[model samples]
Target: MATAASRSGRRRGGGDDEDDRTAAMRRLRVLSLHLQDPSPSSEAGLAPAACAAAGRRRATGGADAAAALAAYLRGRHRDTQARVFEFFLSRPDLQTPVEMSTAAHRELCFRQLCALVREAGVRPLSLMANDPAEYFAVMEAAGGADISLGVKLGVQYSLWGGSIINLGTKKHRDRFFDRIDNLDYPGCFAMTELHHGSNVQALQTTATFDPVTDEFIINTPNDGAIKWWIGNAALHGKFATVFARLILPLQGKGGDPADMGIHAFIVPIRDLDTNAVLPGIEINDCGHKIGLNGVDNGALRFRSVRIPRDNLLNRFGDVSRDGKYTSSLPTINKRFAATLGELVGGRVGIAYSSVGILKVSVTIAVRYALLRQQFGPPKKPEISVLDYQSHQHKLMPMLASSYAFHFATRYLVDKYSEMKKTNDEDIMADVHVLSSGLKAYITSYTAKSISVCRESCGGHGYAAVNRFGALRNDHDIFQTFEGDNTVLLQQVAGDLLKQYQEKFKGGTLSATWNYLRDSMGTYLSQPNPVTSRWEGEDHLRDPNFQLDAFRYRTSRLLHSVAARLQKHSKTLGGFGAWNRCLNHLLTLAESHIESVILAKFIEAVKRCPDEKTRELLKLVCDLYALDRIWKDIGTYRNVDYVAPNKAKAIHKLADYLSYQVRLVAQELVDAFDLPDLIIRAPIGMQSEAYAQYTQHVGF
Candidate 1:
């Protein structure tokens, strides 16, 4: 079963008989790497040219590899876009001590971060480091809407707000934006209440209009109704966009406050000159967070407070001079929908943040893989961990995913780019869907990648200095903050269901008709058998079959999700209705992400130009596709793409990936655009570090 007969051809390395076998053979070598013992190779057998080539891919040669990466990036994707992924990275090797010395961690981190931002000209990203001025300028420049600086305003009820948050109109902007920029009135967004966090409709804060004085009396009726967990509220913010029930006299036309629904009111919390709480409002800090301590968080309490009638944020829904609540939309729910839509900015921001986190993680892991040596022989030589199949198995697929998601993020941002300039509602709605789906996928994945990279580093991974802990802390909120990943996935599923409903109503004579006709058979078809099994890429020389298989499974999975969701909706109700709906839609969102990422990654591989790099990555993509399929192997059992021997076959592809990546890790991580300091794991730092350490340790 395991025969190895060389063909009568001039071959540089071994290959399996079939394309899938050859592909799987690649994966096997990659995984076998993890099982190897730790040791340095004193004597190497490969020729100089081959070793040099391998070095470029593996990070065995530092500055030279980085330079080559810069050159490669200048040509790939956008001809002018530099692969500047590593720009935000700081060295991961230092230990974190609570108190710092003159030349401590903080100073070193700031120096590297600012330098990367300045050198890369990525001003939009400087916000992560809390450069207040640049953060807002780019947000406006990007035409973004109400967003947050990841800080909430007010303690006891001082109010929560962020720079990214929207100020209702030119009036609100005139009144507050300048104060924020000057740090005079930093704020918190008071949308969620203790009683209702995700369910905005259920928030208990209230604003009852006092016709006697032409002011709104904002009050926290009880403890359950109090505003809580507001970031930036502890110290910085001076105002909050408070979401409260808008209670109107039954005779008056204000939308029902009890059922009057939630409305955003821009309320001032502290008197600017004194920094003291307003007469009726109280604030308390949420002190010490798991991460993101950079922003102050707090709680809020409001007594019967008075704010002018004009303070109601009513661009979408308004309050008249007499206290009548009138909205541009027909119903309170519709008006509420518009209000909630602004939160989409948070979704987009989180997606963008995920990109930042992943770039750093991959950089560290790949660089380490290239520098860490293990197993084989001091005479014959073991290999860089990059050459181990499992190393690439853990890191490479995620690399491909990063590429894919990057494209999707760019696509979403471009759409937002167009929407903000034109104020297009349709574009905004689509962006809402995209941001929701992407926020869910990217956040969920970045969390996973963090774990992977941590484990990839072994025991040393848990060290706080490496940034894994900090990155994890900063990003953990991503899963629940902007929106819970589970909930966002459900929303995406709902959007997909809505689309299906619209298509259904389009009948036999609309544009929907044409799409149905054009897509035709394949849209209604089953999984492609060749793609399901790994045989298509059994041979090492030709790779189209492997590529095609990846495409085939991705297509099948998406279609399957649609069909399943459509079927389940017919009978489910109540919790089941929501759960079934959510489950099916999550599947749809996952598939969409998978397809987009695979397509983009392949595009990247195609652009590599190096015959070997392309060939090797093609196999890596195969492994990604195969592993993806195997993950749902239980679901696709009836389908051709899901089978057994192929799993074993694909596992071998890991071996090939491990071997190939040894030569490609440098190139791959370089494309990530990380700086050397941030990638400071002894293994990830430089070619000399590995050599120096080995010599120092008497290896």
Candidate 2:
């Protein structure tokens, strides 16, 4: 019940060295009790009164609670995927050193990847086809072990193998599935060109159909059309799932060929027997990246590369031997959407993996805070860094955010899995918008969170052995790849406008968008005086109030952005108007995604079956909601939705909630269940942290 200042003041009073040491040991013991085995038999190691207190703590929220929460966070596949994570921990050979050259790191990552498949028995094709949840679970575990290994696996399986499964027909699958599964046909995804990254429809690489030879000639027409940053292409991959403009030649005239939009093709870039770059194909290593050097990213250029006609991944669109184009989709735009839609699993994976990175980073920061001691009252033992409000302020909210994102990304994964199963247009549309928005939202948040965590750990975080630098470098590309965060946000905003129009037209809204309709009356009404002035802790923490505030901000932004676009379009026209309002559109998109995350987090808390665990989660949720609302208070206050006094109260409440969360920070991170071997940072060890860190630094 004592405040941090009071605790420090009490320690400042005179005490012998032996007394100070004893007090510190006692505090460490109490703080670490939850890290011990929570079994009743383990209590025999403690005194009777201590054992009784430990029993009470376990009943409230302890190791058992952490285990239950971990299971819940892992979802239905927790048990099935346990071995996947354990597999990495058991193999010391799979672990990369703290330092290595790009070439050496790439070779090590490749060897580690092979071990993951051959020894660990990771069947990505089978899991993705039959068990998507398990496939993602395995991916999270792999990414937690090594970002480079995860990216390599994603390129080979999720991008290359997935293209065959999702975009190609049975014959294409029959030809390549076995080879890809056994690692015989190493491959890369060739989508981004030098001139175009996210603008897939504008990519200039051409796949010209040749009816005479019954083949497709793939060519990079100019320097800008060369495929760039392709993983596994420089030395490892023998094939690539190439994205290009499918062209049909004119029958008699030779003016121009008909461009049938962007499509994917199975193009062989290297020889199978000798691992040599094939004729007319040029591959160059994208050397010395800032991070993820373990991934062999390369640039690919093709000059009149020819492949059989059947190599086209033609589930959505196809061409005949007679040079005629056919597609189930009615128009090029719809076909393009469908083609890109099939690959959305990549975004889902990135969003999920970003959370994994945050979990590890936050875990290290929080654990180090608990162990590292610094300034305190003179003549007293220095207090733990976590005891300071500033340290808690920096870390607890992020810890809370890690939990919030855990549930939100879990929802995304489940939704993606459902979309794959039903193939419902509505679900597909929801998944597309959801994936893009969450992918941008979560990755950007994590990118910032990693820096914050690294700074929170002070000098130790700067050391390479602690992993913050590598984590930052590897994760930095996540926001740009899959889709650029900026462009992806616009996609979400564009969809929001479409739904807003659909609401006006009296069309039924999808489940995710139905909130748009429900919030119409609330958002348009004048601010409620009573609700605006209510600033008590209960009011601030209420799920209803938090959700309403989030919903109101998004709805208001949506309406205002729509009106601005309409007004601007009258003068500037559509493209110009959209460009003028890009900033507003991004805010609207981010607001909408934050609302979705909070809604999902609240729902997850309500669904918890364990009362003690649920109670702990509710506190974390409160911190997440209030901290976000408090940060954006200016937005709420400008509209008179929150009074000055209420704004102050929200800020104080957020601070208090952070202090509360810090009390159980260890238990919260323990639920992530990362092992020491996987964590790899000596300073983040559960016990003997100082010794491990000293040994790591060669003291």
Candidate 3:
């Protein structure tokens, strides 16, 4: 079983091919077991028992709790996602990793997934279309099933296809859109370089226009200029949306060769008929990633490659036959901004998918907790792990956070969809800031949640059968991809400061800006007075109190950081001043984002139609907001946001709310409504887990 990856890696002397092959085989062996369904009859035998607690445990019937939650999460698109999820899950071969461990296996699986998507009659390009409900439905379904598969879908749809649709003109669309939708022209978005990831302006790859031949000469001058981490590049990718600096002779201002900033072009990487790497193009596999090894991630380099001048994706800017560059944008920076703005959809997709992963992890951990029993009183018997105060403490808060993130991600997607139709720059800037902050916050939150979920499962979580390891490994990359979380938060911080400055000048303010404006005086004046008598009405369960606490903290932190930057920039220079205050800035960004999530969560809670659902969800919301403040109660205490005794009291209130949430914990996770096919982990099968284990040992 020498994988295509192994053969190609060896052929190119990539030196890591053997290691990749070994890892794939190892992963396949472990992953294959989960693909098997432990007797459907046995599975049917277990569900009633698992749901028995739902009937008697709390006000919301236990059996219906998960289904209700699922209904809420799936929203108007649940049926669509369910159909798509079942299509992939029904095929055991498609579910297994036998065709996903090596380069060959991954290529085969990638093609299969693409074929499945096409067979479903859902076009990848439709995602970039004005109405993106279907596109997001597919993403939610695929991501829930497998993260690697979801990423492969995103690469083709959101990145490569999106680049063409959003950045290219009519000529480019007519030439490629049909083939792209049909998967006849699998493509990669080539933007990140070896020496310059995240910092696209510093990329070194060059596309020099040759006026004599009316073509562009694309080149990778140094090793650092090579495009890296490009999905589908080693195999399967026939073309790429290449981002490179545009150099034209004597074209700017006077008689000078104009150095237009990074622009995208469509370049052929492989011969369409033979699937062979084209001349002057070289690719090497990025072998054995911790997760997502199923994608054919590869590095690419170009050497004096020539393409027709028409290959430029020039919706924003274009060059004439004489090499004169003309752009509708006023400056190079604006041009580049317009180009990169197309990628905000990709960021939105990643954040949405990250929430899906969080749901899966939490579902598995919660289900396993119900079935798993540890020591109890000697006279009684073993108690389910869900009963332990410590266990509830670990899993419940994360469960609440997942719900908050789910709603927040939904808010992000709606914003993105609306912005696509309008394309208003001011609205677009707000979308960019919100998406960056959210992508960073949600992915970081997911990573922590998955890790906690894994640990909550104890020894079983570490095993492959539980699937937490893969979820954690696959999800960790989200923190860096789309944009690095840290840098993105800084971008949010910068935007906040800019908005704050605008507020001071009496400029018109947006809703969010107005909220910040109204709060400025309170944040700067003094922390609110803490009452001598601690009232539960002013604590965790009170939405107004929660909102006030969050709003005050965010505004205070944001203003403090702004004041520091104002004073320090005088002597230290702009970059130095910001660098010195990076921590405060990041804290400011995080607090702002947390406030936004709380606001969204509270609003959603108010709109819940079911009284029981509303009541329970409000408790979850309380846990989310209060736990957030509990973690940093020290800061609130220091600033008199809460008196020291009240700060301690709020911490106690947060812990008590966690217990309240624990009473309906099973129903809480069930609200996510993940199917067993997606849950995959054996421990999540309730009584079926014990049956499968015993049968395996021939008991």
Q: Which stretches of candidate 1 lie over 4 Å from their true place?
A: 1-167, 252-259, 378-382, 507-524, 527-534, 538-575, 580-582, 600-626, 642-655, 676-683, 687-699
Residue 511, model 1: lDDT of: 19
Q: Estimate each model's TM-score.
A: 0.74, 0.91, 0.89
Model 2 stretches with alpha carbons more than 4 Å out: 1-60, 251-255
User: What do the candidate models score in CA lDDT, each in turn?
Assistant: 0.57, 0.86, 0.80
Ranking by TM-score: 2, 3, 1
Q: Count the backbone clashes (under 3 Å) in each candidate.
A: 82, 0, 7
Off by over 4 Å in 3: 1-60, 98-100, 252-254, 530-534, 693-699
Error of 2 at 196 (Å): 0.6
lDDT of 3 by residue, 1-699 (tens): 999987776767645767778889887754432122111122223221122232224434776766665666667777878887778776766674412466655765585567566676767675557566567767878876667778888888788989889999988888888888888889999999999988998899999999999999999999999999999797879999999999998776787777899999999999999999999999998888888777888999999999999999999999888877889998889999888887898898888888889888988888788778765543445556766657777888898999999888888788888888898777788789889999999999999989899999888888776788888888899999899999999988998888888888987655444568668788777655644235453554678888878888888888888889989999998999999999999999998899888888998899888776777788899999989988888778778778767776676677666766766877787677778788878777534875664554477
Candidate with best TM-score? 2
**lDDT tens digits by residue: candidate 2, 566-683:** 9999999999999999999999999999999999999999999988779888999999998999889999999999999999888877766776676677788889988886688887
RMSD of each: 9.5, 8.3, 15.2
Ranking by lDDT: 2, 3, 1
